[model samples]
Target: MSAATPCVLVIDDEAQIRKFLDIGLRAEGYEVLLAADGAQGLALAATRSPDLVILDIGLPDREGHDVLSELRQWSHVPVVMLSVRDAESEKVKALDAGANDYVTKPFGIQELMARLRALLRSRPGEPDAPQRYDDGHLMIDLARREVALDGTSLALTRKEYAVIAMLLRHAGRVVTQQQLLRDIWGATHTQDSHYLRIVIGKLRQKLGDDPATPRWLKTEPGVGYRFLTDH
Candidate 1:
């Protein structure tokens, strides 16, 4: 009910599984929703916008892959697939189709909860945190809007500071172009992706980074950019 409660949707036709997940997730402080088929799952996904989805490969209406295909059209919600088939090809297929992680059936509840926590920790909707970052070479204090490289302070323009601060806040994860544009440049500027490109270029140059083989910032091609954390 409360907006802060992390929500999990379990899409499985098996009644026992649904009941099991409902109790376990609730006990773990998650708001749980259940669906018996792909259609219901997709509907809940669209309407509820749950924080995570646990999808079963086999459904009465259709395959979960088809459900994932539809979900990927508009949503990038983290999905952990559940399947009885532990075959390599199935896991590959599900991941390729947009499943974030795969857990074979007969899994331990503790392991599943751990995976859920890991996914949530890395999830994009997470609020910005950990104000200070230092990897010896590059250091940033987001709250103070300060950055230093190799012990010397690096001068950065306002836009450069804003973008880099956001990137550093989400290190090791791709921050989508639209998200950057809207957050940094306002919602109306979402269509002006060129502005983001120009700003990012300047930031890279100041950081002494090469776009082709970036040490700190990596381009996600047409989608977005990710800050490389493993220096």
Candidate 2:
């Protein structure tokens, strides 16, 4: 891999899966870090701060979801989940737990690579002063960390502001619950989807979005959530 190659951490208990990912990612010019379980994965994450993490749902020592929760308490590094479970509910659980994206078992390498590229491209750019986006009466000033509705300013708490900022940064894309929790509350709170729900509710209220019929913040049912800019 080149010196400027992005680093990826693979946390899977299955040796075969890890090896497969290691080879595939290396071919794409990424430096890969391997961990056999969640504990080792967390330690490597803290020490190496890899650009992204590819995590398995089932680990030998700890549940992948738990690892994700712990990572969210402190890191904003992107995480893509790998799982054998194909049920939508399971996928939602992973996303709700803060995973950036997920790949089901038996996934094609091409699709996985594409998702990785899309996610990396979707990551927030370097921090800058909050800037404003306006579509008629809806306005958001990121630098000031403020939002306004039809010329009226809306009050928002720290967590609320963080969630909105995240949505704005990734506008038009889904912001996984895990990513939000990690970004807002840290990795340790990623698994607490209730926190995410509460903050989103407050955001919707401030934005004048009806929870019953939301126009801005849209829920993806079992998946995470998305901020609809087309509204």
Candidate 3:
């Protein structure tokens, strides 16, 4: 299989459910991994690093919520909780606990597949950004290292491009100040928030973004920055 193939780990205690999902997921072109209980699931998650996890809420050893909480401590891999209970509260609890989506038992395979595709498209664990991003006014061609705004190329310094590119790659999520600093300027400069602020300011100005009513960059205030794909 190609490296781009998405691997999905299903952690369900039901033998029939596991087999059902294994066949269904494989038929949908997803590489599937199976775990009978929470412990084995957690182990596979840590070792195999599958792109997504389909976890049963009721496991033999422990509740799936506990497993999800433990997994969230380290990994951001997308999780879709499986349960026989279709209660709204149960769904809310799973989502609050960090499950990306929830599927009740006896679900249509096509519906489940659709949800999986949507989650993977917006998955935080995606390894790379799309080659280009164009939001009407701004155009970024990452492969060519080019940035254009309003039909004209704008001159951006190395640091400026790096900051915007990093933000674009993780669009719709907060990229912490320390993360940007460490990735762009190195570990020693992680404490230097000013450098990040300056670069962000420059990029915003060139892109005609206002920090107060930002169209592209949004400040998380003392935490980090998020690139706004919607705005």
Candidate 4:
């Protein structure tokens, strides 16, 4: 792999897993970095700013979810989670936590590679021209990175703007937590679901969305999140 190739961080406690990822990613023309646990992974993520991260849910030092939460505090690298736990609830939890994608244990290498390519291809480049979308009362201006409700400008933080923008871009579709995390926070934070919740809560409050009967932002209950533009 060339030195300038996109970097990927592999965070897994298992040495064999790390070795496998390093070999596979490098063979596919990516520069790979390895970390044995969540703490080291976070440190490497902050300092190196890899283009993508492949994280394992089980870590020796800290849970993968906790590491993802910490990463969400700053960076937005794409994160793909690998876990042996195949329960639907577990998948949902990982997705909700902000993972871009999840692969159950004993996954095929080809499938993982394909998913990685798809993710990288879908990532948007910097906005050169202004982007605006409106379904009547809801308006989003991408160039300005702003959202307005009923012509009233809504105050939002950077992360909040990123989240809502992502949802609006894929309005009416179920955007998994992992996808949201990767799009908004980048690959490294795909496991930070609490961040998603906090930001979504702020958005709901700003838009006057009733948590009891949300019209715009809808929850998928054990899946991910969806933006209901029809509302």
Candidate 5:
């Protein structure tokens, strides 16, 4: 499939529902990924970075609301929740937990497709990250995946680059340690703050940033790290 084609991940337990969505989404020209349960769905979501997600409210392994909570910790991908229950409370819970839309089971394919189209259209044409960033001292070309200090290229390890790139993507804002760990090292490493600390230290050292008087990277003390903008 072309890179521009939107990918949709459907996490549902029922074979019929999964089949129905898989066929319907593909027919509508959307690339489709299917998961039989919450664990598998979460795994795919972490690895694949699909454009959108259709999550079932009930799963064999866990409640979909719980899955949505875990997903919100790092990703803001649009999610349209599916459920057989049409209770007002259920819709409220899903929205409160971060789902973008809710569709009760037995939904018409046309209606579901319409909702999906609207959500996809509502997304920004570009991702949150800037294509490139350059200040007098530091430069980052996210499109080219390059970083330089004072016009000299810097050699960074994969983990190091991942950390710095994530920071630059959200420049001038705090990026929680758990977010860095989960996004770069995987969800299993979210509790391992020391890993993040080591990477942060190395990043600061390479960038010639002082932790005490940070020019680029700032420590949020017991919270997370933030990449300071030149302004």
Candidate 6:
């Protein structure tokens, strides 16, 4: 497959399943790469930077959840967990670990393709992330660093707007407090959690968002925060 083609890395120890996905996904216009274990999958992910990943829960080297956890530490590439076990708890665990979606064995290729289409459609990148963010009552001109709530311009403090803009750039994913501190404040301020708390509170107030029940920014509790991407 050409380097420009949309790449999918399939990580499964089962050779037959890997072969099946190789054929099926290629037919659907995706460039396919296969890995037989979690270690190899992680290496592929780090170096290849494929657009999507299909991970199997039962791998020889590392359990799928552990791989997903490690992957989340460095990459936000969309991952779909494939497993023969159809347990609801397993699905929930994978989802909580940051898998974009989950699929079971004996699954129809059409259904998997449909899910992939939906996931890729929402994935953030060039041509997907708009410069301006507008959601009915709230509007953000990212380039201008301007914000308006309910048609009226909001006079946000420097830190307030910075927090909002940073959150918007990473719309769906959690931005850890350490990252926020380093990015918004300075590396020196990474230890100052209070700075982040104060800024987020003021930003919420400016956006007319209630901390108790967020309308735009949601708190992830002890980790960080993520902006609502539905808009």
C-alpha lDDT values of all predictions: 0.88, 0.83, 0.88, 0.80, 0.88, 0.87
Ranking by lDDT: 5, 3, 1, 6, 2, 4
lDDT of 4 by residue, 1-231 (tens): 123688889999999888888888889988889999997887677655678889999999989988887776555567899999999998888888888899998888789999888877675563342367787888888878778899989888988888877776666665667767777887789788788889989989888888789888888654467777665
lDDT of 5 by residue, 31-52 (tens): 9999999989987776567889
Residues 37-144, candidate 1, lDDT per residue (tens digit)?
A: 998988777555688999999999999999999778656789999999999999999999999999999999999999999998887765556699889989999888
Query: For residues 1-231, what per-residue lDDT tens digits would candidate 3 score against the true structure?
Result: 134799999999999999999999998888999999999998777655688999999998999999999888656889999999999999999999999999998899899999999998887645667678898899998999999998899999999999999988888766778778888998789789899989998888898898999988999765578888885
Q: List the residue pairs that clash in candidate 3.
A: none
Q: Give lDDT: candidate 4, residue 79.
A: 83
User: How much does candidate 5 score in TM-score?
Assistant: 0.64
Clashing residue pair totals per candidate (backbone < 3 A): 0, 11, 0, 15, 0, 0
What would the TM-score be for candidate 1 when compared with the true structure? Answer: 0.55
**CA shift of 90, model 2, Å:** 0.8
| Model 6 per-residue lDDT tens digits across residues 104-140 | 9989999999999898889876435557888779999
Among all windows of 10 consecutive residues in model 5, the one with the lowest summed lDDT is 123-132
Q: In candidate 2, what residue range of length 10 has the lowest lDDT sum?
A: 123-132
RMSD per prediction, one decimal? 8.9, 10.7, 10.1, 10.3, 7.6, 9.9
Instruction: Identify the runs in model 1 with alpha carbons over 4 angstroms from their true place.
Output: 1-3, 125-231
Give the RMSD in angstroms, all C-alphas superposed, for model 1: 8.9
Output the better candidate (5/6) by lDDT: 5
Worst 10 residues of 1 by lDDT: 121-130
Best by TM-score: 5
